[model samples]
Target: MRAPALSALDIHLFQEGTHSRLHDKLGAHALPAGGVRFAVWAPNAAQVRVIGDWNFWAEGDAMTPRTDGSGIWEADCPQAAPGQAYKYRIVTPSGELLEKADPFAFQSELAPATASRIWAGTHTWADDAWMRARATRNALDAPMAIYEVHAGSWQRENGEFLGYRELAHRLAHYVKDLGFTHVELMPVTEHPFYGSWGYQTTGYFAPTARYGNPEDLMYFVDHLHQQGIGVILDWVPSHFPTDPHGLARFDGTHLYEHADPRQGFHPEWNSAIFNYGRHEVRSFLLSSALYWLDRFHIDGLRVDAVASMLYLDYARGPGQWIPNAHGGRENLEAVHFLQALNRAVYREQPGAFTVAEESTAWPRVSRPTEMGGLGFGMKWNMGWMHDTLRYLREAPVHRRWHHHQLTFSLVYAFTENFVLPLSHDEVVHGKGSLIHKMAGDAWQQFANLRALFGFMWAHPGKKLLFMGGEFGQRREWTHDGELEWWVTGLPGHRGLQQLMRRLNRVLTEEPALHAFDFGPEGFEWIEADDAERSVFAFLRKGPPGTAPILAVSNFTPVPRENHRVGVPLAGAWQELINTDAGEFDGAGWGNLGGARTVPVPSHGRAHSLVLTLPPLSTIYLKGPTRATNA
Candidate 1:
């Protein structure tokens, strides 16, 4: 039997599990002979046939299995052409026919319609300058404030979803004006259920046709790239939905998933986990990761639910999971797969990065695989987000008792290359909006939000704020409607929006705020022990010769007069940002623009500044040296 003309190297890599470019060989490839070559892996199939528009949807064209017992079936159809819909018809040992969508399909019929389409086109990317500068832009010390967005819900026109082409222009302008460095899109992969929010992906390769075609999505990325905004895709590689046309039960066998339900099923999500032990499956997933970087020019991938992948007993109880060979709960195969994935992405896609949404105390999550780590560029600082929000949710009177929550994150702040994410997960499922999470009256709530954001920006880490949060969105996020854009016209909300815009500008412009975010040298405590006043102060440092900035926050509603905060050097200090400024709809109490330092040692510093601290406010002060003031 003549198998598909796969090279010896490709076969070896597929079997040994190191091939990351399976897209070149699998699925439907347009042949130069006015036809297409189709290949699928159905090891347990008794017979496989190609049934599509070219074949009049009949099973007359049977595929030949590889002579080397690789379980891959292939066929060359001279009559099959691009833009035709197709599916694999496999006859199982039980004599039952199973039809499935192509796993590597580049395009598919819009959801509720599952047939894969023969799509072939190359996008003309015009972001060469952006691509070349990405390495410097994404470096560890550079500013990276991500604006997280759900494409379908971010904006709509006349109650209908805007196509990617439209979003390209709109989103690019908004993010650019707001001073965000990157835009992280929620999954855009094709999914059958809109409620899943593209998480339960059915098409790993196809961009959801809900937002126009694949090329439209490419255009969207290119537009953003040209506008100096990096695009990061939220990729889900942990599990897949068990749709009939998806990877589940392919070839009437558990070809892609584990045969054992104990290891295959995700109880929480009701999804099927990949059989990471399989070399071919590893290659398939790796290829999917690279496909985005190679074809779509994606800047990075934020891998979802990594904790679930790291542990075999995740979301499971006793007797429901199988231990690894070493009798541990860790999924060794999944670990190897993740390492391989990170290695492949870095090796193939220069200036691209990967982030892990891991919630556990998984050590070395952002460290390199060569050092026995997961090798991601960053990891979500879930602990910080939870603890900080938990503290802010309490009234100022009770915040003192929970003061450790505000200070706990700093204990391990630099453990990983962290991104303090205020992601969609925090504002959904009754958790309430970020503004609503603050505990107080309407005015106090807005002040608390402004203070929280100021503190977050001043903290040592990269930042990511979800859509709507910047404008003081009062409603919880729903994947169905637009953000509370109207709130931007209101005084408090509008001020909050302006405050955030200025915060982004400060975060990007102040080298002391972003430089060395991953190390302790960039951060130092000025007065972390001031819990009685519910006030916190810290210092952020830049390069050796650059001056440092001091951040002070007053969580209580009562204003403090003659608030003495330590300074490293003796000179004039200016208020850079005051959350209570009149422009931010606060009472406008401030230090009359600037203050001179006194020669009084405090908090281990030789000089101190006696300044008025506004109620429920946070202030950023740059000083201690005339150079910084100048």
Candidate 2:
């Protein structure tokens, strides 16, 4: 019940590394005497020492320092430096030898389990450009079309890995060509293994060996910016994989983590959850968040497995799990740490988005800091993804969808900013392709995908589609192998890719689709009937003077000559997009060069939008004004 509070001297430790300002040169405060000075927090420890490559585990190499005013130990050792590799060894009050890294390390010159190095990477960033550009960047509510991909697999040329330079050259154009506004890359931080998918991170500052050198990562990001695309790194701060050669048992003891299994181990993932209440660990996690934001020119971060971080019972059985003092599963320390991380990142790099990908319903994920919220820019709407996928799986095009389930997103859309993503999770881990999820033959499946994409464009929220979905990747994604490249050669899959290109184009040309970028006023339903006609419709309207777009989907296989989509405004309406167009692997029932206006029976409004909706297809109607006004 008594987790001690930070004392006056505890705050002094932060001043050592992050003091004054980051200007033309490294601050003098970073240096501490003859060689290098290393320090770690171990309040109840009997003795402490600094371990590094310099000592070779010899007593002379071991550092000795008394507990400071803040309960932290300091060791003026020769092993510390900008590139120096080192870790901490603490002899606890109970006579147990423990070891961990300098949790406040600017860079892990070696690694968690390895000794220190005196790394001297060259820096050329002025921060002027980064600051100026960040000021005018897109907001959370804007039309964000994210292209999520793993860095290692995205640019495999004949099974060979591409360095940051090669990937920068290739990925930038690939994203721009596909018309995605943002690139949400998988975690790039150095992890000990390749199988954990960067979740079990140990080297918090080092980019992985699999991804080439550290500078290579910088080149990739800078190149992406040059291409007018934003990059978001998937950051893992919640836990670190327990590898003996990594963060676990470094220097000899659990210096950066909790010694007790209750606080130390994460059973489900076989990782070690950070002790957020610890001063050094907090500094480590916070600095890691800021490092990516400041050093990389990265636009944002998609925090991985936020649920695991916020829960004490993430993997606990009914009786084994315990609640916090507040009678909730919420981890207050982790919550506070997250809030601080967001606050620091935003303060240092304004407009830089920090998004959480929590599967469970964590409230106020996108709320402002002043409101007791974590102050994240947005949260992945996993509920929307799950609900929508369920509806799509069972309900036929003509069948009525549970009104609540279909509209459930709207409730949370305004709760905090949201991004509706059909991300890698949809395809990977045994889930079939988006197209395959539909109930139909292969041809119908592709059509279903096209129609669903049309629905995505018409819906009122931000959008994100995983890589292989562009051209209907047939097989479920596998981390061990490449994507279904052969599927692109097939007409059906090729059509899906073309349709994807068209979807982006239309989304860009129309304002209403992106209007809901940050508010509820952006979407208005025009129709939801599934009985009389085998179709449903909706309207996405931006601000005034921004054209309102009507999206209509026909689920049946019968060609309907005149399908009326209700509209509030008037003027010459045109078909902006149709999934059935030849470009999208359909019969191309609509015209490429034409405008049409007709009345809706239900609305009894003249000058309304009408179009030739092909079987199992979707179409968008865009015009100057609403038919009701006309």
Candidate 3:
């Protein structure tokens, strides 16, 4: 028999919990000599055998255990060929036999089937330009408007799912047209349940075969990168489902998760939580994370359910959870794992970054590890999303009393390099669509949504809008159905789509909007105290030579003529965007093209512009500064 696949150094690192590239050594690999070399980690197994279509599912070819005591079983099967589905038949010490799918399999059979396929990636990438310059494009200061999408539901042909290659061209064209900088895919990793939306991951290394094979998914990312759109995958390292063929009870033991239910199980998700304290499990997760970035060239990863991972008492009542060594509620092991994960990601994939979907007010979530932080690149602004949505649901007559919701986010806008996400979570489980959340009639609802978007874009943070939102889909998001693509035929919906395109263009074109998003100097309030009138105004500033942008919002239904807003510079301010303009299906009440600041004092500024504030709308005006002139 050939020597074991793992070397002495691999054994040391895997045991030490620092091996980041275990994928290259473990799993089934096509040997250059002939056939495939299979390896798996099952220390408690008395014997392990490779069973597959090539071997007639027989137990004749028993795997050899490593002499180094690594508990890894290896077998060189010259008869095993690519595309053959296989599983490890492990015999436990108590004579119990368990057939398990390869944990490190790069490709798996589609849902309703539980076989791992023998495959190797052979995709030739054609995204050199995007890969080379992605560092600057993915920076915190860059304009990043992500269009969150579910691959299967985004679009389907004749009620059938489109392959990854097909979704690639169509999605890239649509996202490019809308001017979104990135497309954040809701997990495409292999899962047994289609309705789980890839969250209950069974094969971390495999792209779901329901869409396409490994190379086809690779083409998906490559094509999007070629079109200058970064890809961010929603990754769930927090917990995994306890399917019989999955990571649960491997080798007749809780190898990947804790044996104690209090520490291992997630009551809310009804899944098994990863035992972050385990050395080999850490290597498995870290390797899984790097595999996507290395093989698929993913631009970033949005770590889902981070708050659940951070707290031991999360979703648990007293005595149902365990405390850390310091007797605190924090999951110390998970904290170390997250910090290590982020450090490894940044060090290995310099251009790529990570975001945390942490709902709690966990301090320094996006800060660096050395600064006593979690070391994530960004965190979702759940507070802002919840507050803004709650305030928008109120009637216009009652908006004045809840005006603080609109202004409260700025108090901590720069806390963790936030991303203002109006995500799919808000539109599911009877929450209704974003348009329906507004407080008004048909026209006013549309107007309120438009104003909310305008204010969001002008706000100091990165932006993310889920699918169906660009065109104002009237129903809640369903993973089983496609977006209402036909709604673009309607005047209001089409106008909303047009507004999204225009807003994205303005966000990307203007440095003042994105360049200083995390800096307080880039923003200032001009009329934050106008709760009685339910009006708000603010200024967004860029670098020295760049032009400044003024954004004003009227939450009420009454239009205000000659609403004086302070201006820092004396110049002709052009109306860059008015959500109420006739083009956006609004009242069409706005300043006639531009407004020139006068010597009149207002809002503590020497010069002020008397502007027309349309009802239930927000407008952005660009000052003619040196950058605009140049």
Best TM-score among the predictions, by candidate number: 3
Q: Where's the lowest-lDDT run of ten residues in candidate 1?
A: 621-630
Q: How many residue pairs clash in each candidate?
A: 0, 23, 0
Candidate 2 segments exceeding 4 Å error: 1-10, 13-60, 70-118, 123-131, 246-264, 395-405, 531-534, 591-595, 599-601, 604-607, 625-630
Q: List the residue pairs that clash in candidate 1.
A: none
Model 3, poorest ten-residue lDDT window? 621-630
Q: Which scores greater on lDDT, model 2 or model 3?
A: 3
* CA lDDT of each prediction against the hidden true structure: 0.91, 0.69, 0.93
lDDT of 2 by residue, 1-630 (tens): 311233344446443433112211211113434465444545566776766667765453443434344445555554445644556666666676766544444444422234333444654543445446654545754567888887776657788677778888887887788788888888877765676777778766667657565566777777777677788889998788776545565445575666777667887877877877765567666667777777778889899888888987888866555577888877887888888878877888877889898888788888877898888888888888887777566545534544445556766677778788899888877788777777577777788788888887677667888878878777777666566777787888888887777787777667678856567677765666454455767777776767777778776667787655556655577777888888777877874544566544444444456567787788887767533311
lDDT of 1 by residue, 131-241 (tens): 999988888899999999999899999888989999999999999998999999999988889889889998999999888888999999999999999999999999999
**In terms of TM-score, how similar is model 1 to the real structure?**
0.98
Q: Compare candidates 1 and 2 on lDDT and give the better one.
A: 1
- Give the Cα error of residue 75 in candidate 3, in Å: 1.0
lDDT of 3 by residue, 1-630 (tens): 466688889999998878889999999999998799999999999999999999898764689888777789898989998899999999988999999999999999888899899997699989999999999999999999999999999999999999999999999999999999999999999999999999999999999999999999999999999999999999999999999889898899889998999999999989999999998898899999999999889999999999999999999999999999999999999999999999999999989999999999999999999999999999999999999999999999998899999999999998889999999999999999999999989988999999999999999999999999999999899999799998988988988998999999999999999999998988989899899999999989888788889999999899999888888788799999999999988889999898999999889899999999999999999997755321
Per-candidate TM-score against the hidden true structure: 0.98, 0.86, 0.98
> What is the alpha-carbon lDDT of model 2 when measured against the actual structure?
0.69
